[model samples]
Structures are given as structure tokens and as C-alpha cells.
Target: MDAPACAATAAQAASLQALLNTYLREMAPGSAVLADDRSTVEIPLSHIPARLRVRITYFSATGPHRFGPAQILFDGSSTWHSAPPVQVLTLIAQECFTRLNSRDAGQLPEFLRGLFNSNAGIEQNLIRHAGTPEPDGFLAAEQALTFGHWLHPTPKSRDGLTTWQQAAYAPEYAGEFRLTFFAADQSLVTLGSAHQAPADMLRQIPGLDGAFRLRPDEVMIPAHPLQAQMLRLDPQVQALLATGRLRDLGEAGCAFNATSSLRTLYAPGCRWMLKFSVPVRLTNSLRVTKHNELETGVLMARLLKHLDADGPRFRILNDPAYLTLTLPGRSESGFEVIFRENPFAGTDGTGIYNLAALTADPLPGRTALLTRLIQQLAADHGETPADTARLWFEAYLTCMLDPVLDLYDRHGIALEAHQQNSLLDLSTGLPSRGYYRDNQGYFIAQDALPRLNALEPSLTQQPALVYPRAHINERMAYYLVVNQIFAVIRRLGCDGLAPEPDLLLQLRRRLTTAASRLSGAGADFARYLLTAPALSAKANLLTRARNVDELETEAQEGLFLQMPNPIAAAQPQPVQERTDVLT
Candidate 1:
């Protein structure tokens, strides 16, 4: 590749850097972050007609850790000598390794290669993994390294050519990658001619590329074929009195509750949703596991992380009670106490099995943007076929509630955010609205609060009373943000609403505009809590939680909310065949 192409790649990546950061922060927070001086992000790369500007970092594009510690340097020119790695390589590798033995045509070599070639590092792995040991070092494991240049055949096909050569010409593969050498430890230490990274540079990054850190605890709703193979041996569970498999983290009074939100709930470290909450029924105690609680923490962290970052889908949740609790049952594994506030106070209602209704329709959220949500989400992302551009507007809400539980637990901080008292939105599945119905308010124990006085501290009016830290944050974002003033554009990303940019930009404008009208929610409410200054810094980690089982999120059209009136939706009319063939 030439300098211009490299520069273009850099430019494209740079231009969209802010946009991507904004989106990622909202979608996944643990991984999305800014550079030291806030100049770059982990995914700092671009593609142009000729060259690509690159940042060589030890990042897994598709792995659970999106932004691990990066060297944070750039490869000024696109050194074509070695393979050109795309920014999303690591993630692709993680996903590929995850889907290595899958039966889906969508995950075959050709498709996998496309995602991998996008990341230079992954392509190197592809080369190394495919090689065989030679007398000197190694030989091409499979002689003749014929990769993406020609489509690989899958087991499902017999009329092979139909699936290969006919593939659309979009330069389907990513940056080029050839064979590379791995050290005794299977690290990408040595490379052949295509080694663009110099020895010194290579030594700097070393071989932590595939380093094992934290295992992901995701629940797979439709259990991907490869996910089954990735489940590691279950870890021992932890509780106040005893220990066993994570599934057994409770004593006599543990709740065996569950959720159906997560698409995948069986990821190694994140499998069950049994130990986090107060025990409702004790009979199902044996069914809980550690994987369950871990997933809950992950989910909560993701939720709060998004709110802490800047995004168009900001939720006005102030409760930080969303964290991995060490209670009995599975709730202990995952975080507990989801804050029901504006935004996430709703559901997508995209039920368990809607294959028939989902036939020719694109993404349901994008399709119903106009009627489903505010006018903003419908306007963003473009008007392509629905299936082509789908975003999880429901995710925006689930993410909101899940985070409050996250922040509190991580800090060993607890807030009063009971689900029964919380309000959730069930309005249009994708397009919905959630608010602190009656401002039930955030609560803290009589003596353990005040740590966040800088945020909002005042002497407790009543004896032993403490301040509600989470509530303070909520009022700032909700009343001061989405409501109170109309200047800020509602950053609601409901599909078919205006594009995300317009909505967020408008939110900023409106937030500043109506900054003064937010006193109705209450002012002194936050100043009354106490802090648990004496609590130990080290928290007892939990293990027996699991994710909620996948259930029918999809429901009747009006399941989420009641319709103002039963207005009949017009069905699509068939179009007549065109007779212009002769003309």
C-alpha cells in the first residue's frame, strides 16, 4: 500500500474516532476508553484508497477485552512488507476462536478470513496456526497457503462453485497476511519476509497478545455451536458461611431468581443468574452456579460504564446499587439492585421466538422507529433495508438498569434500589421511555454513605441517616438532562428516530438550555446520607451467580405499554409486476 492510502485509512479512522468512541462507551464500557492524553482510542486505525495509518497495540478486536493495555504507538506508513492488520483483529480472533468449530455458513473460513484480514495480527495467527513443523523450524501445515484469494468450501455445499466464485466483489478479505513464525511457546515472536514489525518493536510488545486475563461470563441465548466447547471447568462458589461450585453460593435463605435479557448466558465465567438477589424460594438452590453471578457483574459493569461515558443513549440512573452482591443463591455471582430510572425503565418485548413475524422484516426496532420511539432514533443510521442496519434500542434500557447495580457493589457501596419499587418502560419494544415514575428516590443505610460528599454532601438531618449518592447523579442526568429543559436533544437512539448524532447534539443543546428547570425532583434529598468510612477496602468476592435464562422478550405489539387507542396498523400492499422488460 502507498502513503496516500495509509493516510486515508488514518483519516477515516480519525474522523470516526469520536463517533465510534461515543457509540462504544454506550454499548461496552469496560473496554472503551481514551488514550493517555485522550488523543487516541484502542481502535485507532483507518483505511483509504492507497494506504492505512495504524496503531500497533496488543488488543483483541473481538475478544471480551476490547481495550487491554496498549503500547499506544503508530505505524506511520503502511509497511506492505508484512501483513496489514485491521484495528478489529483481536476481536475477530476472539470471535473466530470462539466460533472455530461452528457449523454456521456465516462463520466459515471465507467469512472468518474477511474479519481476520481486517486485523493484521489475526492474519498472522491464521498463517502460523496453519503451518507444520519443518526440520529447521516449521512447514506450511497445509501446503500451498491458499486462503481468502479463493473461497473455501463448506460441508453444506455440493454445487460448490455457486457459493464461491459468485461471491460479490467487495474485496471481501482484509489487509494482506502471509506466513509468520511462532516461538516455542506459540507466540508470534518470529516472522518471515512479511514481518513489518521490527525486532525491537516486536520485543517491546513481546508475546502478551494472547495473554489470558479474565474469562468472559456471557450467556448465549441461542447457544452458538462453538460456545459449548469453550465452557471451562466451573470454579468453586463463595458465600458467607460455605463454599462449593459457584452454583452453590447460598445457604438456607437464598433466592433462585433469573433474567432472560442476555443473548448468551453460558460463557465460561458468566453462566448463571441464581445467587445475586434475596432468596425467594430455597428448593431450587442446587441449580445455581458461580458463572451466573459473574455474568451479572459483567452486565452491571457494562451498564454503568456506558452511563459514565459520553453517548447519545445516556440514561438518567443515579443508583449505584448495581454490583456483584455476596448474598445467597446466584445473585451473589452477578451484580444486584438494578436502578429503575429514565431510559432503561422499559423492555424490548422482542419475545423468545418470533421467526415467523421476523420473516422479510428488517430489525423490528428500526422498522417501528416512528411509532415505537421518539422521532430521533428513526432518523439516524440510514434508511437501508431494516435487516442491514439494526441497533439494540432495548439494549440501551437494559444497559441502564444493570449499571446502577454495578457501581454500588464495585465500591462495596450499597444503595436502596428494589425492583418491585422501580419503574421500567414496556412501551414500544425497541422504542421506549423509562422514568423514575414517582421519584421513589435512592437510599443508603443509616450509617454507610457520605463517601461521595464531593458529588453531594451535607450533614444528615436525621440520626444515622446517610446521603443518596446514586440519586444525585440521576437527578443531574435525568431532570437536568433529558427533562427539566428541552434544549438538549434527547440522545434516544431509537431506530427510525432521527440519526444518533442529531439526537445527541440536540440533547447537548437542550440540556444546557433547560439546566435551570430541574428543581422539582428535589434538592435536599441527596444531602442526607452517611458514609461507611470504616468498611474494609478489600471486598469478599462472590462466585455463584449466573445470567438470566433467555426467554420470550418479544411479546404482543402492545405488551410493553398500553396503546392510547387500538389503532389498526396498515399492512403492506403487494406491488404489481413490471411489464417494462420488452421496452
Candidate 2:
């Protein structure tokens, strides 16, 4: 009836099925979406939207292993004349679980990639990625789970109806795709193309190496022309191919490449800061940055178009990166697009008083330093409220836990919470608004799935995204709570006090108790901040990248506007301002 299920050699199919069962049960345990009847199931993915969407059906285990059909519609079609089954769908069930749940939702629990990526800091990233991972391939069954089936739990507004269908979560991939089967080392034209690239040198092709292939599952051609297959990469990803510029932002081993079309973007209400990659020149994933950055911004803007602080601000402007996107559009090969930008325009840790500043140099110690100033300024005016300082004091502070709650309430565990990827505006400082970014952090559903009963209806049910909680915690511990937050505080010591390392323990305690009923955001926890000794001497908050005495001299009254540190500031030279022009 169905194309003979498990088309691979019996050994290969069994081995893959077993590996998948092990991976999913362990990493994504209690995933209610798992059809409990068979080792695998088949539902054609071709009848759905062209975006990242899924339609699930199931037949779980009564066999050697349980399996189900998720039917991910990647550019839907009944039959896409593709490469051989081995080249495309052999052990299709296994890949469906591993790739969709692990790679897309970020990472899975104890997944070696996540383990190493999170625990290994920056020094041993490759070693981290190289290690064999857990066999959670059964997750593909969960991929078919839709919003009505699971939806994010927190941010309980009518907006909860939003799911990872189309606009955000598309079931497309790069390696071993369902599109045309390209030989890893197949001779690729490897043409060097970009906007403003020299026409004479446009087609000097190189070789495509390794068993590596660019299988863009979502790509389709009504009529195959120059190439037999087309790949529908993320729009932002297409821009990378089109522009070819992404920067190697420093990491332990440069985990992900990021380039920038604009040296800076000063979007006022944007949730995530947009940062583009360096102009790309390589044809491998190793060198190219991921596409979610653009999707991060665009998706936020479009989805939150109605909400207040929940969504992101977007600018589909023709930035320097636009040059690349434009050319790719002309090639008529661009699949989908994604985008991002820098958000630290005015914030240099100045313009307000925060806990990080509590221990840092010449500023006065742990008093409500900024608050006191506002009260003084207000009292001076015989005013009633001193709301001014409170607004400025909430630097880099995030939405109490909206994003994480949004995920956890729905999917269970959403990881990657930190100050750097977080966007907030103290420009008006009541700590009223901010944006969250970085999708490749963490997710966990294992424990929570059973606690809440996945099959039963609960207020927290969410459209399915691989719920990988343990993996999420690891990211929060490493990237956000520890690395980014603590690192920034250490850099900006309070008043005359030297930076202390234990500051994280203190901060962690605060974060842990943040949601407790007794506390309005765990206030009593970090109050040592209030008693911090005042500066041996001081200046306004805007005096960034400078000593207290120097900064004080530069402060324009206490109400500081973000400005570059004097002397070291490289005011953009008109000639240098255009950083995107190719030489």
C-alpha cells in the first residue's frame, strides 16, 4: 500500500530505528506527540504550506520499535522527483527525529553537540561538536505536532495562538536533504558571485568537496534549467550566498560566523539587535553564518505586530547586506530570507545605574545610586514621584521571563537567557519593554511532558517544537547567566571596588528566586546592591570606556546620552563609513 516502508537494507533500517528510539526516549522523553504504535510511519510532506510547518499523524509501536509519521511539508508536493532513496530518505524516520527536534529547536538534552557547545566554553568547540551524540532521532514524530497540540505556555494572551508554523519554523535542512542528491565532492561550479563582484571573475568555479551536499529540501523547480534541483535556503541564508560576507565573531573556536552590513543599527523598539555576517566567500556551512538572525527580527516584528513588549521591531532596509540579497534575487535561485542587526547603539552600560555598576570603580557603592539622584532631582523640583531614575537603572535587565515562560508554559523548557542577546531600553527606564533573540539556544520537554501529562489538555499546551529542557538550562547557565551577565559586571566594577568573581553566585540566587510569590521579581535576593559602597569619586552614566574622573568631566549633567568614549572613539569617517563596499 505505502511505498514499501523501511527501504534500506534490513540491518541499516533496524540500526537506524534503534538509534532513533534511544535518542528520543532519552532526550525528548514523554513527548506525547510520539505515536506509540510502530517503529515508523509514512505521510507525504507535500500538501502543506511552503514554510516551516508540519502535519502529524501516527502509528506508534507494537513492533521492534515504535514509529510515527510527522509529514513535514517542505515545499509541499505529492512526488518531488528526487535522488535515490538512500541519498534522500533512507532511515528517513531517524533523520526526521534528530534533525528537526535537535537542530531546529536548537539542541536536545545530553545531546553531545549541546553538551560540548554549552559546557566546553570557547576553547574546545570543535571537539565538542565532534563527539558522538545521543540517539534522539525519534523526535521527528514530535515535529508534526502543531500549535493546537502544544503551543508555548507563557505570555497567555490571544497571541498564544501563534505557533512555529510557516512564518517561523520551516522543516528545511542543508545536509542530506530531500531535494536533489548532490555528491559530496561533486564538481560544483563554485562560482564566486556577489553584488558588485567583478563580472570577468564571476564563474571561475572551484570543486565541491567531502560527501557534503547542499540539499535544500524546500527548493523546487517547475522546470529544471541550468541545475536539476533548487534549494530553498532561509531568505537570510540566501542573502549570505548572495552577498557572501559574514564575520567570524570570536567564540571558543568561532562556533557561528556573523557578518554585518551595517557597522551599527539604532532601532529604538527592536527586541533583538540586528548584526549581519561578514561578506561571505566560502561555500561551506563551517564558514557561513546561520539564517535565524534575520528570521529572529522579521518574525518578531510580524508576529508581535499587535502586542506591546512581546514582539520585535524590524527594518527591511537596503543595508549594505542588501547588495548581496539583491543579486541573489536576480539569480532567481533565492529560497527564503532571514535577518539581524546590532542593538547597542546608545547603551555602553552608562546612562543609568545598575547592579553591575554597584561594584565597579569611582561610582559610589551599593546605594540606590541612580534612584537617589532622581529623588534628589525630583525633590529639587518639589515633584511627587521620582520615576525618572527607576527607568534608567534597569540596564540590560530582561522581561522577567516572558520568552522562557512562553516556551516553558507551552513546550516545557526553553533555554538561552542572557543579557547580551537581550534587548532593553532604559532610555525611558521603568524597565517596561525589551526584545529576546537567539533561537539556537535550548529546549527541553523530557521531564515536564509527564509532569503535565502531554496527552491531556492543560493551560500550558503548545504547538510542538522539540522540548529539550536540560539542554536549555545548560545554555542559561553557560551563555546567559554566567558568561554574558557576569562578564559584563566584572568589566564595570562598582565605585572603587575591584571586580569579584563570586558575583555570579550572588546574581544566580537572585535569578533563581525571581519568580517566587514572596518576591516581586526576587527583590530581597540581590539587595546587597543597595548597600554597595558609593564611588570613591564619580561621573554621569554616559561616561563609558573611560575612567571615573575623565567620565565625570564628560557627563552632560546626570542625564547622560550614550556617546563614544573620548580619545579612543573612532568617529566614522565618511570614507570608512561605507564598510560594505567591495575592494
Candidate 3:
């Protein structure tokens, strides 16, 4: 390659190295060696034993940094060469497989390819987003995530999607298309909901016509285009088509754009967002809606409705309805679709942003939406950014943390409130309301099972939906604290908007205050959070290295590594405090 091409390659490799370094720090802390000043880090290659080491400049421990080209060291000297990110990851995976004496090493290449493809998709998405006219409120926020997860090895990896398919279906690519419709006989369809049936909602879509003639006992439903193609090849679907039990009505209705969750589609005019079950491998799982998930959605809606008779502190985007066809000899329907209530429907200019997207880096030459919002808030309040950050962080706690803890402490409902699953309704650039989505992620404590069953008797029969208090608390610690809240703090520090130590202090104080107000298992969990020496961090790279299916694996079964607790490290003392501690 020429000089300019070589420089470009080195820069690309550095970007990948930065991503890998972040993942290693979070998931495999043993691999990193930090300097006393916390200004430099050396990561030894696990696959190559001690033959090579990756050295880079480090800023705050948990915040994003300005990483230069990773230097390749051979023996004890610099080789003056840089390894591409995929090469580094491949070496790590090879080492892991060798150490475990496992036979799944073959899967690493496929994952590497997916990672490369994902990077290309991200690059293209950013270019597209920059060139296109800026979309309005929620849509703009939703499409802003050029890079998905900072800690995941391949956050945007989609193995099954072709180039055209990614352009049409990936949320980051701003994909918009009408859903493919399918008609199933009433007897062969399973429907459940808190309000109108799935069939009724489908029949009411305005300007939807020419798909098929719906019989009195038949109903129309939507399917993802890719998933619809897969279903056509199924023997059962073929038999149903031959028997006139199911009809391929083709694509019809208004175009709905893909959300951050690629399988979920949002149409501004529709009353509900449609989440379909796509069999494509996205991130760590095949995006398929299980039978239990459909049932759990209805159950959770009823429970939340019963609990929040007056009004709820946090809004739950209820999965009110689902439609799926029942094929003979099939254990579960893979074409299931969940109809989630659209909270942003007919909005009065209240901007709702997915918390994850808001925190992500904006396109080139643009500030992050959250950072810009904070600056605007500071300008309005005549305060510094730090002061506004503190205020905004506090209000965010009241809106998010308070309600999440209340649900767990009082109701034994543990929401998987990761960054992506949580939404913030911003009023004047500060969080005024919070919404938690994803019915498949709810975990009801066993103690609350009886109460939940009292509301919906069928819940007891769903063994996969409930767990012990300890298990629920563990999940809560990882999702709510480690992934969601800490991510926000990291972003603030990375952008120089707020010092991480100060933010950690504020977080600890808020948790302490909330703990004092709670009782029983919730209080116990709160105390644990404040006092625990280390929190469990998800081992995404290690999990992917092992070729595990995340959706099928139990939460406990997922790989975890101990990450030093920033809250504990940030505890204030009577004497003058030092801010050099890395957490």
C-alpha cells in the first residue's frame, strides 16, 4: 500500500484497537496493566502469551480516551508495526480456545467477518446521516447511534444481513420499509392482548389495502421482510399455503422505520410499534420472539395496570398484543409479532430519545445530543456545565433510579434497564419522564410470584419468567448500575462535561438516600450496591469467544468478570480526598 493508504489503514486499526481495549478493560481486567499516574495502559496479548503487548495512552479510567496507533511489541522491543483490530481479536480468541481446550475455535472467523461488515455499515450510516436532512425529534435521536455498544466486541455485527438488506433493515442506516403481510385462519392463530386484539389493530390501519381478501374468520398480520422470506421455505408454511390455511398477502400499509432495536419498527402515525421475530443473528442472539415472551407481555401489562391504578412513576411500554400462526408439529411459532404501545404517538413536541442513542457520539463535526442539551440547559440557567450536569444528573436519578428501585424493592420486578432498553423523555434538555421497554427482559422475584399470580393466575405456570431474589438482584446490579448508569457517567467524563469522581459521589449519595427509604430485600440490595467491592460485568468478548447464544443462555450462565466498584471507591472521607484512584 502507498503512504496515504498505509496511514489510513493504521488509523482504522487504531479505532478497532480502542474498541478492543475498552472491551478488555470492562470484561477481562486481568489483561491490562495501568501506570501509577493512570495515563498509560499496556495490554499483553492473551493468545500470543507474552510475545506482544498493546500500549496506548489512557485518560480517565472509565471514560473514552484519545487512543493513538497501538504499538506492536515483539519480545521486549517495538516492531514499529500495528495490528488490525480483527487480527488482535483473532489472536485473543485463539488463546482463549487453546486455554479452554475447546473445539469451537472455528466460529471466531465468522464473528470477525461480522465485525468488519458491521464497521463498514457504521461508516456508511454516518455518511448517510450527515448528508441527509436532519430528521425531527425522536427520529433524529433514534438514528444517531453510528456505533452501537462501546464495550461489545462487535456491537453492530449482523451475520445474516447482506449489504442491501442492511441498508434496508439496519436502524443506524435509517432503513424504512412496509412490513410484509400474512393472512392466517383464526383457528391457526394465537392472539393475546390487554386492549384490542392484534387482528383488530391490523384491520384498522388506514390506507392498507390490496394485500389479500380477509375472510370473516381470518386476520391480517405483519412480518419482517427477511423473516417472511425464511418462513416461505418452511415445510409447515408450505403445507398451510397449499391448504389455504395461510396466505402470503405480500407487503402493504405505511412504511415504518427501523428503531435502534432492528427488529422493532416505528411508524409515527401508528398507535403501536411493531416488534417482529427475525431469525437473523444480531449481536448475541437470534431475534426471535419465544412463546413465553408473547404470554409474558400480556401478563406484565395486566400487572402494571393493576399496580399503577392511579399513575406510575416510570412508564412501561406495554406489549398489549401479539399475533402468530400455529403450525402442526411445531413446538413454538417463530413468526410471532409483539404490538408495543407507542408512547410518542401524537406527541405535543416532547422529545423522547433512546438513552443509548443520546449518549452515543454524533456525526463528525457535531456534538453529542446529550452534551448539546446540557450546554443549552446551562445557558438557560446561567450556570456552568458542571453545575448543570450535577442538576441534570440528580433529576435523572429521581426520574430513573428512584422508580427502578421502587419497583424492585416494593414489587420485586427487576427490569433489564440497560441503556438501549431505557428511554428518556426530555423537557428542556433534562429528563422529565423515563420509559422502560422489552417485555422479554422482565424478571419477577419468586416471592412476588404469588402476588403476580394473584393478578394473573397463568403466571405461576410460566417457570421461565420468575427467579429468586438473589438472581434478580444480580441482574439488577449489572443492567441498571453497571451498564446503564455507569455508561452515562463515562460519557459525561469523556466529553469533559463532568468529572467521573464527582458523578460517582453523586450516584453513591443518591443510592444511599434511596436505600434509607426502602425496606426488606430491596434495602438489602441497595446496601450491597453501596458496599460491594466489585460489581459483575458482562463478558461479551469472552461469551462470544465461547460461541454461546445469549438469548438461550440463563443470566447466571452468561460469563461475568469482577469490575471494581466506582461507588465504593468514590466514597467521601473526613480528610482531603485524592482524585487519582482509578475505578
Candidate 4:
């Protein structure tokens, strides 16, 4: 048998870049030193008590940086030598454990395991699919994320799925398979629907009636095939199946494709997207649909209608219904399923791309999808790519940013509009419409309780929906500004379509204008973005080190650190008279 090769490939280099980027943004800001020209950077591994140096290929003000292989000098060493990504991970983990005062850093093993799995997944994806032209369609774009979150250490890691399962179930592999179904007795099932009955809606899936039969007294529950396998092993579930209280209908539906979030399955012919709770762990959380999340989905749908939340060019794909099985002694029976609105059905979904998929760093030797789209638009419009990018970006801000701020300003609703949850319609080769989706990402300001209560009296029932104004502001600053907008700027700059500083200037001007016209939380948040020297960003590395399940933690509890605000740097002038408003 041959020993596993240790050579650093593209996968390893990418992993290294992600880890270093997270460290610099959320952990090393005050401790690390950079050269005047930013040609090189020195990072201090305080726990290991070593100094690491690396050549900066690209220094992004928005935190996505490119660096050469690293070199480290130990406390007693007089020379610096090469260090691999795994070595860097170890030192960073040590630093986190020490700084966090962890008595038992048991999650380190799991973290390392995920890194290995992620590397293997990336290698396989590159070998099989890199440089291939992106497929056309909503589902194809969802599966285009071969290399996952660029800032995550284990972006492709899935703890519970075997290689065969991944081939059949993972979006990256473009797996399209039948959904696993079960018919549970009505007494043992819970169905919540805001508009249409969930079970009735499930029956409406094309060819679903032919696939399986449901008894008059039974309700159908659909799940990710992987989740079905795990549930069959659950002792409580096994008891129910053995007693004939629940009958496993097996994989019976028409082909369904896994979306970007692995557990969410989509079938274009179907009117709804089914989000399930899988046993597998993805990145920071175990992908389970919490009970509160199910209720929130139904509640939020009604609330949106009451608030008339849908803007002219922006809207949310609401989760209006859900179904799950009730198992004794368990709050969640591993059967929680959410029915999300599917606006992108068949031809209607064409040219609509999730913002993350559009901005994701492309495989080696290939241009980014966003860059390609902009270049094509430039050619069609007889203009330079830079000019097209500016125009496209302005449209994106109006369609996406303006609506989000308006929601917060008028209703105190702060959406978790991170890239993955954001979508854009580029049917004309530029963003024409923006969509935000996710039942679990809505955050309402507690200060607006009286106003919201009057709008939707049910608001008092969902106490978890409201959060402190400051908390919502912090999240908006990160999700809306740092994660979503900054990603767009980074994509344009790195792809050579436009300069990042130029985009940042554009963003600052837009926010300044918004502040002058907006009121309450929205104006305050916009002003903060325009003037604050530093912005809060989630610490993905530290979160992993602590093994925090992001879904389980409060919005304010997630690990966060301050980083230099790119918008502030682009326009250093103290809040001047508002003159950049766009009519």
C-alpha cells in the first residue's frame, strides 16, 4: 500500500487561505502586523508562541486575501521555515483553546476530522468538475458551489454521509434523487400551514400521487433520504414502525435536487421547496429544523403579508407550512420539515442565481460567474466591463439593499441577508430583482414591539422573534454589509471588473444618502456603517474551535470580532452634508 501523498495541492492552498483569512479578520487584527505595502504579513501565534510570515498576493480590505505558502519561526529559532495548513490549524486551535479558557478542547478532534473530509471533497470536486461550464437553471447554479464557503475551514465537510451517499445526495455532486417518504398516523403527526394544508400541498407534487399512497387517516412526511436512514435507526422511530403506527413509504417521489443548503430539496415542478432535518453536520451546525423555526416560518409568512413587506423589486420566498412526526420524549423527532415557497419553478427560475453562487471563487483557470456575466453584459451593451459593473452594482443596491433598509426602518425587521440566503434575477445579464429566503433568519427589533404588535397581534406570541435594537444592528452590519455587500465588492475587484475601493465609495455614498432620508433603526444602522472605524464579523474559526452550533446560539452570542471597515476607509470624511442621494 502507498502512503497518502502530503503534497500541497489547490485544495490545501484554498484551505490555508480560508483559515488565514478568518484568523486575520476575527482573531489577529490587533496582534498581527502588516508591511507598509502589504506585500507581506506577520501573524503571532501566541499560544504556540511563534511568529508566522507569508507573502500577500492580494490584500483585500474586505477580508478575502490571497497569500503564498506560510513560514514560521519558533520562539527559540533564528530562521523561518515552511509550514503547512494543517500545522497552521493546530497552532490556531491552540491559541483559541488558550484564549477561550477551555478546560477540555474535545471539539478539536471533530474540527480536524472535518478538515480532512473537506479537503478530500474539494480534491474530488476539482478533479471531476473544475473548468466545466456552469449548467443553466436554478438547480444547476445551486450545485455549482464546488468549493464551498471561502471563509470556512471545513466548507465541504459532512460528518454523517458516506462517499456513496454524498454522490447521491450532495448538491456539489449535482445529485438528483427521489425523496424518502413516510405516512404517519394523524394522531402522531403535527401539520402547521399558513395558507395551504401542508399534506395537501405535498400531494400536489407532480407524480407524487402515483409514487405513493396515503391513507385517509394518515399524513405524509417527506425527508432528505439521508435523514430517512438515520430515523430508521432511532429506537423510538423503530418502535413506531414496528407497531405499524408509521409506515416507511421509502423513496417514492419524483426526482428532487438538493439545493445549496444540503438539506433543502427542490423539484422545479413542485410548488414548494422541502427543507428537512438531516443527521449530518454541515459547517457550524447540525442541520436540524428546530421546532421554533417551523412555527416562525408559518408566523413570518402571515406577518409579511400583514406588513406588505414585499417591495417592488425585492421580496422574500416565504416558508408557509411544515409537517413533522411526534415522537415520545423528543422535542424534535428528526422529521421536522418546512415547505418553502418555490417561485423559481421550471422556466421561471432561469437566470436567477443565489448571490453566493454568483460571487463564489471559480475553479483554477476559470473566470468567476459574476465576472463572466458582467463581461457578457458589457459586450452586449457596447461598454467597458467597469462601467457595466458600476451600473449592475447600483441596480443590485436598489433592488436588495434599499428594500432591506426600508424593512428595518419602517417595521424594524432585520433579515439575515447573507449571500447564500440572497438571490438575484440576472435574466438580462444584470441583477433586476432581489430575493431573500430563510425562515430561521428573521430578527425583529424589540424597540418596535408596540408598532409591530398593532400590525400583527400574533407578534406577542412569538417572543423569540424580537431582539434588542443594538443586537439587530450588529447583525445587520455583518450580514447585510460585511457578508453580502462586501462579497460583491470583493468579487468585482478580484475579477478585474471594477476596483474594490471604487465600489466601497459607491456603497458609502449610498448609505450616506439613505441615512438622511431614513428614520429610526435603519438610519442609525446606515450611519454606523458610514462612520464606524470597525465592523463586527463572525469568527468562523473560533466558532469551530468552541464547537458552537450557530443555530443553537442566540444572535448576539455567536463569536464576533471587529475588523477595519472598508467603507470607512473609502470615504474618511466625517459625516458631511448628504449630497449623494439617488433619485
On lDDT, the candidate that comes out on top is 4
Write model 2 residue lDDT over 1-583, tens digit each, in one string.
1112211232222222333333333323333243344333333322233211112222221111322222333444554332232222232333443434435342222222221221111112122222323111111111111111000010011111122211121211001111111111112112111122211211111111221323432111111011111222345434444542321111110012111111112232222222323221111111122333323233333322222223332111211111112223344222222223333323432232222222111111122232343444446555433232222222233343333444444435444443324433333423434444443333435555463343333213322323344333433433343333443333323211222223333343334344342232123212212222210111111111111122123211122121111111112222212122111
For each candidate, what is the lDDT?
A: 0.24, 0.26, 0.73, 0.83
State the TM-score for model 2. 0.29
Name the TM-score of candidate 4: 0.93
Give the count of colliding residue pairs in each prediction. Answer: 125, 90, 0, 0
Best by TM-score: 4
Candidate 1 lDDT: 0.24
Candidate 4 residue-wise lDDT, 350-454, digit = tens: 998988888888876678888888888888878788778888898899988999999999888999999899999888676778999999888889888897778
TM-score of each: 0.26, 0.29, 0.91, 0.93
Better of 1 and 3 by lDDT: 3
lDDT of 3 by residue, 1-583 (tens): 5544443453344346535654556534675776666655666655553533454544654434545444556665545467555566566555545555666546756656766665665656655665654334676667767777757666667777878888888887776788898888889988888878776787655457554678888777789898898899988889888999888888888888888888888887787788898867776677888787888888888888888821344787899788888876775666799989886765632578777877765555577777888887788767788777777787788778888888888888888898889888775566777888898778888888887788888788678878888777777888888888887887788788888888888888888887899995678678888998877777776776566777777542457777778787886644343332111
- Candidate 1, TM-score vs. the true structure? 0.26
